[model samples]
Target: MDNPQRNDNPWFMALYIGGAGGILATYILIGFFAARWLVGMVEGPRYWIAIGTISGLVLGSFHIVMLIKKMMGEQDG
Candidate 1:
């Protein structure tokens, strides 16, 4: 029998993989702006941007991990 969790169409997998870049970029941008807003650092040695980028990296990693797990049908109920 065909697996139910996976998509029957193979092209959809490519779509997901391609979309990963957009997702990661979006997460990073959001984190960066959020940090800027929270810290109110418009200029002059803004360290918050670094912090935000790192935070975004971490969050994005988690999101990517979850996405991979879901795509692989390893998601736990």
Candidate 2:
């Protein structure tokens, strides 16, 4: 049987890379914008952006981890 992970398909690899990157960037952008909007409404401490960015990073990392886990499971199962 042909192993699913053994195939070094460039296009498939590119797709995964693009998807992971897009997902991470999108999450970060969304967090930034959401925080920016919140800041606009309330004037106080300006650390919301940092919180949003960190939140985005954490969520994005979680998504990537889940994605990799699923892919690996598919290959090994």
Candidate 3:
């Protein structure tokens, strides 16, 4: 009997990467715009720094969720 090949489907990997990349890109653009607006109105370097840090945290959390979901899907498959 032949053994089944695991990880044979590249499409699955591509789909996962593309979807996550798209969302991350969108989040980054939105974060940049929001930060720009905030900095324009807030009038301080501290506020700019805070906005960047917050955006990084948000993006990082989103990436973590995506990673968990991908892992779960792979396990289920």
Best TM-score among the predictions, by candidate number = 2
lDDT (Cα atoms) of all candidates against the true structure: 0.80, 0.81, 0.68
Model 2 C-alpha lDDT per residue in residues 1-77, reported as the tens digit of each score? 56655546799878987899999998888888888778888964579988887788889989988987776566544
Task: Give each model's clash number.
Answer: 0, 0, 0
Score residue 39 of candidate 1 by CA lDDT: 72
> How does each model score on TM-score?
0.77, 0.78, 0.54
**Model 1 lDDT tens row, 1-77:** 54576785679988998788778888899888888886775664578878988899789878988888878776454
RMSD after CA superposition, every candidate: 3.3, 2.7, 5.3
Worst lDDT 10-window in candidate 3: 1-10
**Residue 45's lDDT in candidate 2:** 58
State how far residue 27 of model 2 sits from its true place (Å). Answer: 0.6
Backbone clashes in candidate 1 total 0
Q: Candidate 1 — which residues are off by over 4 angstroms?
A: 41-45, 75-77
lDDT of 3 by residue, 1-77 (tens): 23344344789778866877777767767776677777778775656756775796688568858785655555542
**Best lDDT goes to which candidate?**
2
The TM-score of predicted model 1 comes to: 0.77
